[model samples]
Target: MQIVILKDAAEVARYGADIFTTQLQRKAGAVLGLATGSTPVALYQELIRRNQAGEVSFKNATTFNLDEYLGLSGEHPQSYRYFMDQQLFDHVDIDKNNTHVPPGDAKNPITACQEYEAKIAAAGGIDIQLLGIGRNGHIGFNEPSSGLTSRTRVKTLTKATIDDNARFFAADEYQPHLSITMGIGTILDARKVVLLATGENKADAVKAMVEGPLTAACPASALQLHRDAVIVIDLAAASKLADIEFYQHIEAENQKLQAYLASL
Candidate 1:
């Protein structure tokens, strides 16, 4: 696990984008696991900029979104599928057919979940997974007390999660009380993971994730057992982390080391 604290959200986005672009550059067909929510909006925008400038290309890459509202179709504006299309896919040259989002309204949701897991395996597993922790320490809708070794499947949304997502819906509109999400076990399979958080709202969650014990209570903490997990946050979001200065110092030293090695 590596903690990278940056000056602000924009810097966090640049750092996240660099990680993805580097992965795609090294492996053109790398399978990318994506997440929805505002935390990654800037990172997606940065990737689009790089694509437009010819600095990188996602034409041969495939992507899988982390979760989707249980009853919404891909065409629904609030669905993760639509979110990805408007935010990243429509602007990039990637093949639309290669991108996958769980079938939220499938006739047989159980079977759909099974197929989703199989599809990921067939794609040779994810090379890198992008994540954004919820204020309650949830990841991919695996709320508090969710199984640590759970798999892709239907999950009931806690009241806290529903409330957190309420802001995205209109006052009188319906909001989903269920979702299909990849489990902690599935996410940990990724060769690499990058989680980004920003704003003061996320400070507490960030602290718990980085400093808290590995427990199902904070699903994101499962990353502690992952071989490679990188957490990037801005000053506002990293405020509650007791060892913030230590993390910053290490990041600075790492940069200097990389530069020294490159020059040699």
Candidate 2:
């Protein structure tokens, strides 16, 4: 895993967006893995701006969202499908038919989970995946203790996760305690992964993910085994990382090396 420490949230968003932009530029039809949450919204906005500016195109690309609330239909205001439509699909030239979010209203959720995995396989696997870490270090609703090699499946949300997300629902709104999410193994299958986090609230999670052991306690740590996983965070989120300065040094040296190679 490569840890990239930046100055602030806006810089983190731009850096993460540039990774996606480069992937799409290299392969317009790349299958993208997406995540939903406040942290990724800024990155999505940056992508939208690039698309509108003719810097990139999603016209031929296909997308799959990481998870969805189990009891909500796509039309539900709180569903991830609706979120993506409003935040991205609607603003880009991508074909709506090519976008896929796990079926939240499936009669047999188990079957739906299996089908979701099959669909990803049929798409030739994800070329790049975007992610946002929860305060507790959960990724894609795979809370603590999730199997390191688990696959697409229905999962029960932890109390902490539910409480953290409670703000999204109205006081009397029906909030789902269940979700369908891609497993840690599933996310690790991506050719490349970019995880973005910001704010002081995420400091501890960032520290654990970057320097913690490869244990299920922090699901995001599974990325440690991935050959190409990039963790992008602002200084606020990166505050608790013990070796922050070393991470910054590595990033600086990497930039210099890239510049040297480019000039040659």
Q: Return the top candidate by lDDT.
A: 2
Considering only N, C-alpha and C atoms within 3 Å, which residue pairs clash in candidate 1? none
lDDT (CA) per prediction: 0.94, 0.94
User: Could you report the Cα RMSD, in angstroms, for every candidate shown?
Assistant: 1.0, 0.8
Error of 2 at 190 (Å): 0.3
Tens-digit lDDT track of model 1 for 120-223: 99999999999999998999999989999999999999998898888889998889999999999999999999999999999988888899999888999898
Which residue pairs show collisions in model 2? none
User: Tens-digit lDDT track for model 2 on 57-86?
Assistant: 999999999999999999998999999999
Model 2 residue 198 distance off true place after TM-score fit, in angstroms: 0.2
Instruction: Give the candidate number with the greatest TM-score.
Output: 2
lDDT of 2: 0.94
Q: Each candidate's TM vs. the true structure?
A: 0.97, 0.98
Model 1 spans > 4 angstroms off: none
